[model samples]
Structure formats: C-alpha cells, structure tokens
Target: MPVPDAPVTGAHRETPEPPGGDRPSRLDPAIAARLRRTPDGLVAAVVRQHDSGEVLMVAWMDDEALHRTLTTGRATYWSRSRREYWVKGATSGHHQYVRSVALDCDGDAVLVSVDQVGAACHTGHRTCFFTELPVSSGEVAS
Candidate 1:
C-alpha cells in the first residue's frame, strides 16, 4: 500500500514552499534509510534516562513514529499490541523529551536518550520492568 504524504506542522508550515512548490521537511537521511529498510518489520529503540543513565524502556519505532520523534523532539513508538504509532505520554503526564537519538551498528535498532518527566512504566514504577527474576533461585523479586 502507498503511504500518504506526511502532514506539515509547526512554523515550517507557515513558511513559503521552495521553488519546486513543496519542500521536504528536515529529517535525517540515515534515519529515513533505516526506516525504509525495515518496511513493516520491528525497529527497537532503547530508551535511556538522561540523568541516571537508566534504561526506562525498549519500544519499537515505525516510520511514522520515528518521523514524529525527530520532528517533535519527543519520544514516540509504534505499539505492536495497539498496532499504531503512539506519542509517548500522550494520554499520561510522563512525557519523554528527546535529548539525543542514535542508530545501532546494524541500523536495525535505535537508542534514545531522553528527559523522562515521570514514571516510564504504566504501573507507576519508574521503569517498565519493575521486578527482576533471580537467575540462581528462579524467583521473581522487586
């Protein structure tokens, strides 16, 4: 299926188009290339907290999600269970502002350093994985 043209947003929309009648928005070519390579497959993003260096979450990014994150300077992800692009903390108050973004060696994964406002987990924990299972005992503990 053909993808629709992405909607223009922010002050750029008010600016006049180039001589060509339409100007492409500022998105990293490398990121775009990675998205195109993946198609509908998974692209993992390792979400890290800026101050503590904690890995808050690992979310997937679709083309739209990656575009939104780059354009808005916020964290966005493609939710496999929901089957949609979801802006981080859109409904919740725990928004994540992008500090920096990087692609992995194979270009199939991403690392996003962010300023996480509140809990990254839905369960009110600071991180998604609240409890860890002990390998030796095979017991789950917080």
Candidate 2:
C-alpha cells in the first residue's frame, strides 16, 4: 500500500496534503474509496461509443483525471507517455462527450460511455481496435 502522503508519480500536479494528513487524495472521498489503482496510481478507463457500443479507446486515469472527467462531463485522461493530463480531442477536435461512467466489479477499471463526435482513434479510424485477431477454430467438448 502506498503512503497517503506519497506523491502520485505521473500526475500533472501534486496536491499538498491538508494539515490533518489523514486524507489519501484530493479526489471525491466517495469515489476515491472505490478505486483500486496500479502501482503507478492509475486505473484503466475503457471508453465506448454510447449509441453503437463500439469501444473507442483505452486510457489511464489518476484520481485527479477521473475527478475532472466526472465534474466536467468531458473525457479526461492521464497520459503516461506525455506525463500530463489531456482532455480527449483537445487538439484533434474529435471530442468525446461523456454519457456515463461506471466502475467495474473489481474496482480496477472504469467503463466510459461517450458521444463521440468524430474518429475515436488518433489514426483517423472509428475506434482504436481496428485490427482483427484470428481465433483457432475448434469444437467445444460436450
């Protein structure tokens, strides 16, 4: 378990601990209590198109990113590569307007349903998962 005062490694900005020092995060207490984060303090967020049920992308969210997404009704993510917080389509103009957010049963991942305005994939595809993976054809044993 991480210490309450330890800085989140990839967060864009670190929030100073309040005087009492018992609070583990700046995220809403209710939401924070449910999250099971990676060692780097991130949760997997699987974004999907609300109408088509097409999975758009998978992103990472720290507590702050999740909080921002919840409060703003926009998709926000913590970019591991960029080491920053990025609002979806902020640069590409392909926005994801959040419809709903759900935490998975294990509390390790979140499902983000959104109204995707344009291409969800950065490569101009509809979704990030465009390649088909072949499966072995086999009969089930009865």
Candidate 3:
C-alpha cells in the first residue's frame, strides 16, 4: 500500500479509491479536504469539450454527484433546482462522456473534460456561455 502523503505514481493514478469515506486518505487527505463546499454542500464543476477544448458549462456537484462522475465515466451533477441527481444528457441525449477529471491544486474546484455528444447547453447552444459581458472600461475588465 502506498504510504500516506506520498505521491501516487504510475497505474495507481487510474485506480480510484473506494468511496464512502469521511475524507480521502490515500493521498493527502488534508489537502483534498481543502475543497470548500457551499453551506448547501455543493462545489463548482467546470465541464469542457475534450477534443476541441471548447468551454462548455459550469455546474454544481455534491459528494455523491462527484463520486458518480468519477466512477461512471460520465458527467453527473446535483441539480440545485430539481433537488435531485442528474446525469448530463440523460434527458436531452446530449450526454457528456467523461474523458478525464482533474482537481485544482487548491482542491476547491474540478475540471472535467468530456466527449460531448451534442449541444451542451439546454438553450440549444453549443455552450452556455454564449453572451459576453460588455466591457464598459478596459481598466475595469483588467
């Protein structure tokens, strides 16, 4: 078994740890636990197009949602409005097949690159971030 706090190497990288723990200890549990969840117990997930590298949409994920995403090789999220778990494209047939998942160093956010099947946005657009905010002043934006 790998020692605690050690850098996991090689094939072990692909082997996800078994879920249902209070916190992950295989790597640095403290570091991973740094991920801040909202008072409602949610974190932000950034989903992207794997091949074209197009920015898709951002969503919220709870622990179960995140676990489902990792184990199933698909993008899953916690629907804040519906008050339920959602597998992307489950209804629209525009599913997101997860290619890889990465956590930022701060453990505050997740990036999921996926093979998007069709339109990623519910608005029938390729991405949800279609409208750009007007830049009133270059200095303000900078």
Q: Where does candidate 1 clash, by residue pair?
A: none
Write candidate 2's Cα lDDT for 29-60 as tens digits: 89888989887778999999998899998999
Q: Per-residue CA lDDT of candidate 1, range 29-66, in tens?
A: 66666543344455789999987899998888765567
Instruction: Please list the C-alpha lDDT of all candidates, in the order they appear.
Output: 0.68, 0.78, 0.70
Sequence-dependent TM-score of model 2: 0.81
**Candidates, ranked, TM-score:** 2, 3, 1
Candidate 3 stretches with Cα past 4 Å from truth are 1-34, 137-142
lDDT accuracy of residue 34 in candidate 2? 93
For residue 80, model 2's alpha carbon misses the true position, in angstroms, by 0.5
The count of residue-pair clashes in candidate 2 stands at 0
Estimate, for each residue in 30-119, the C-alpha lDDT of model 3 and write its tens digit: 534666766666778998999888989998876767877888897877665545567787767788899998887766688999999878
In lDDT terms, which candidate is top? 2
Give TM-scores for every candidate, taking all chains together and pairing residue i with residue i: 0.70, 0.81, 0.72
Stronger candidate by lDDT (1 vs 3): 3
In TM-score terms, candidate 1 sits at 0.70
List RMSD in Å for every model shown. 10.0, 8.3, 12.2
In candidate 2, the residue pairs with backbone N, CA or C atoms under 3 Å apart (3 or more residues apart, or in different chains) clash, namely: none
